[model samples]
Target chain A: MKTLVIVAHPQLADSGTQQFLKTSLQNFSTVTWHVLAPDVDVAAEQALLRRHDRIIFQFPLYWYSAPALLKHWEDEVLTRNFVYGAQHELAHKELGIVVTTGDAKREFVAGGKEDYTMSELLRPYQALAHKAQMSYLPPLPIFQFAYLTDAQKQALLVTYQQYITNSDFTSFHGQELWFEGQLKAKIDQTKGTSKQQLTQILTAVQDNREQLEELRWTLSLIKDNEDE
Target chain B: MKTLVIVAHPQLADSGTQQFLKTSLQNFSTVTWHVLAPDVDVAAEQALLRRHDRIIFQFPLYWYSAPALLKHWEDEVLTRNFVYGAQHELAHKELGIVVTTGDAKREFVAGGKEDYTMSELLRPYQALAHKAQMSYLPPLPIFQFAYLTDAQKQALLVTYQQYITNSDFTSFHGQELWFEGQLKAKIDQTKGTSKQQLTQILTAVQDNREQLEELRWTLSLIKDNEDE
Candidate 1:
């Protein structure tokens, strides 16, 4: 599916985390990266939205929401007749948010200093999605990007790729199947030991899926016994 | 107390509710009305905040939060060192939100289509206030402004006046005292019959305060009795 990542930061070029995240998506030919400018072409933006199957708004959490630039873009680009009313040009398209926060993920909870979850704070976007009849995906929150280790960054890169490209990243079974399919595709293209390694990884993924199904069945049986 | 109302609506001139609200505040000499422009003066904006005891960010709710212009004002005007850190210019000042929503008040709650309370959605502003060490006042949300009856609009004018001008508008006892004080001052400035009418209203206000105090005392006694 075609993916659009709209990055809205005042100083995006200066931001290391945002730069890294942008660079990680270089390999995805289907992903289009759009950065906000002071003066935006409204028609061009609308056209971009129309083309993308999945629309991701990526920005640092400024005052618990998007920057003014993004907000302005929304107000200007998403006009009533075209985006909302009878026409509803954006219906059935997927909407996602990739928010980077300066605070730790733990701080965004009911009893924490922030005093609310990211989901609660980001409800406006979800409401927007609902209004447009679009599928609102769960937000991918990258917390304390500056403090993350190299390994954590690598893990985040993989997750970010999945979030932007993979339609069913939220489901474990779906994600495993997607990864296994990737390995299966690579097995025929690779040479020598690399092909063998790809086959081995695909076999392991299939075996793990079977084990997970068994575990789920056992848990369901236990629940049934308790119900009796 | 000097009150500053920062109005941030892109189409403020066209909005009937906002225009009426603006007209209502003409009597308050201490209340400075600042309408945000496309290009804002950062230093002058900071100076206005310095002059005002209470700062109210007034705007129509766009995407469940302040409009882009207001967000831009915050992003540009409220900066490090000036608003926070060592200098902390905004500390001890009261921060208020005056938001007008097109949706009905009932729609903004748990299990409703909106799926979140106004307070929950506006937490980002509250958190911003916390960060700046500013006292965050309860937000004044004008719901379904277009659908409000004339009588409801009149009541809203009174409440809005109190919110902007009265230092302790949120407190019942404080509001009573303020109303009583206003009547007392008006009595001095009026003709014989008008003076008499003001005196009578002041007496009623004082009597109500006494009645409220008695009710609170009786309720506390019941609680104490239950504890025993």
Candidate 2:
């Protein structure tokens, strides 16, 4: 599915987290990066939104919401007639949020310092998705990006890539397929022994995925037999 | 307490509900109506916020949240340093929301068309209040102002007045005291038989209040004895 990542940050140039995310998506032609401007062109935005199957509002959390720029775009572009009106151009599309926060994830709980979960903080967007008849994706929260180690950052990159491009991001089998596809593409460009090692890794991934699928099928049959 | 009603409507003059609310607060010298401009003066706005004991963000609900203008004001005016820095000016102050929606209040529920409660939808503001160390008041949602009958409007006027002016806005005793104070003032301004009738009504109100207070005292004594 085609994805639109609508970046809404005032200091876009200054944000290292945004820059890292932008660079990671460079290889995927399926992903389109649309950085929001303060001045909104309602028709153009609506058209862009219409073109994409998955619409992601990516921004650093400001006062537990999107920066005003994105809110302005929503206010101006997602007009009543264009959203939930009889036409309902955005119906059945996916609405996803990618929020970056300076606070640690643990601090966003009932008794935590923030005193609310990311889920609670993001209800407005869920409500928005409900009103427009769009499927709301679970939010991808990148918490304390600056504090993450190199290994953690690498993991985050992979998760972010899947969040943006993978249609079945929630499924483990789909993730394996996505990883396999990426490795296969990388192996194609490589020459020599490294390519052979990459191919070995790809084979293992494919073998594991097949075995898992077989196990899943057998498990489903067993469950059905038990029900009978 | 001094209350600043920060009106944040893109089309303020056009809203009959807003106009009605504005008229209701015309007599209260303690209430200040500060309509937000698109161009927010951060320093000046912060100063205004500092001056008020109660800061209210009043607007029509857009996309199940406050309008973009109010969100914009929040993004800019409420600076990190000013709000939560060394000296937190907003602490112990009250943060109030006066949201107007075109939808019926019933529609904002789990099984309703909207599929979320107003409290769930307005959590962003509550989070903001938490961050600012402000006391978050229960929101005053004015749903479908155009559909309200004359008596409903009058009742709304009284409630709105209490929301802005009455210190004990949440308690029945506070409401009684507020009404008594208003009636006594009205009685002093009247003349002749009307004055006598108004004085009688005020006396009845005063007597009822005393009786209630005595009853409360007796009930508390009974509870204390039961505890012993």
Candidate 3:
């Protein structure tokens, strides 16, 4: 799919995470990068958006949110008639957000100074996606890149390259339930399973469940602590 | 107290509710009205903020949230070391929000298309206020202004004036539990209420709670019906 990445960072030259991601996507002819500064013309932005199939808002999270210019772009480019009231201009198009956060994943949880989960922090964007009638993708979050060693940064860059180029991204909606159903179906597909086969499948499912539970528990604990 | 009103409508001239409020506030010598359009200089904005005791963010809700420019202002003006991190510049300042919602009050509930109450939608601002160490005031919601009759609009303007000018504004924050323990001791002497009279004084507290619950339930019901 033709992807339009709207890169919004005040100082891209100084942004290691953003620069690395942009450089990685440089070889992809299908991907168009629109470097949006605060002074970008509104008409030009709207025109650029009209030509794209999938729109990705790429930004460094400033004070737990997108920088001012990106927010300004949303206000100007997403007009009432086009994005909301008239309907269908953005319908069926995919909307994605790629954010580079300053803090570790733990700092975004309930008790952290940020006082909200990444999901909670991005609810406004989800609401915007709903209004625009676009299919919202799960955000690609690069956490604590500022603290990463050079080797760690390279590893993250590799992961990011894989993340962006992957064609069959899992949809964000009801993800857990969908994955669970898939796992059950896979288990059922094995007809006349031996004890060994059953044990293997069960082990994989148990491992997946354990990982999911750990993530869920950590998030819940953070949320509970935040409430206090 | 000096009140700084940051009017954050992309097209303030065309906005019915915002225009009316702006016109009504023209005679108030104590109120410093800052019209924050897309073109506002970041440095000038910060300088203006430093002079005010009370800061009010005025906007029309777009896509169940504040207009993007308001978010832009938050990102740009509420900087690190000033709003947070360093000794707080906004610690003693009172922050308020005045929102003109296109959706009816009934349409902002649990099951509605909006799927959130105004309070829930406004959590980010509250979190920002908490971080900034500012006294967060209850939002002044001008609901269904498009449907209001001329007489009703006039009455609303009067209420708006009272809300902005009232000397006993501390009472509004006093009713909020988040502020109760923190601010009650300091203001209790002024309230002439003994410790024994706290229960009797909490009648207003109970009333505010009931109203908030009613609003939440009504919004949810409206949203549920809208989808059908």
Best by lDDT: 2
| TM-score versus the correct structure, for each prediction | 0.90, 0.97, 0.69
* DockQ class, candidate 3: acceptable
Per-residue CA lDDT of model 2 for A170-189, tens digit only, reads: 98988888889899889989
> Would you list the clashing residue pairs of candidate 1?
none
Score candidate 1 by DockQ. Answer: 0.58
| Per-residue accuracy of model 3 over A134-204 as CA lDDT, tens digit each | 88888888888888899988877655654454444463333444344445655675566564586576678
Q: What value does the lDDT take at residue B32 in candidate 1? A: 96
- What fnat does each of the candidate structures reach? 0.58, 0.83, 0.39
**Clash number for every model?**
0, 0, 3
Q: Could you tell me which residue pairs clash in candidate 3?
A: B109-B219, B109-B220, B112-B223
Model 1 — TM-score against the truth? 0.90
Question: Model 2 over residues B1-228: C-alpha lDDT tens digits?
Answer: 999999999999899999999999998899999998899889899888889999888999998888889888988988888889777989999999999999999999998989999999999999889988999999999999999999999999999999999989899999999999899878878999999999999899899999999999999999999999
User: By DockQ thresholds, what CAPRI class is model 2?
Assistant: high
What C-alpha RMSD does candidate 1 show over the true interface residues after superposing them? Answer: 1.8
What is the lDDT ranking, best to worst?
2, 1, 3
TM-score of chain A of 3: 0.70
Candidate 2 colliding pairs, count: 0
Query: Once superposed on the true structure, which residue ranges of model 3 sit more than 4 Å away at CA?
Result: A39-47, A171-228, B26-29, B37-47, B63-72, B167-228
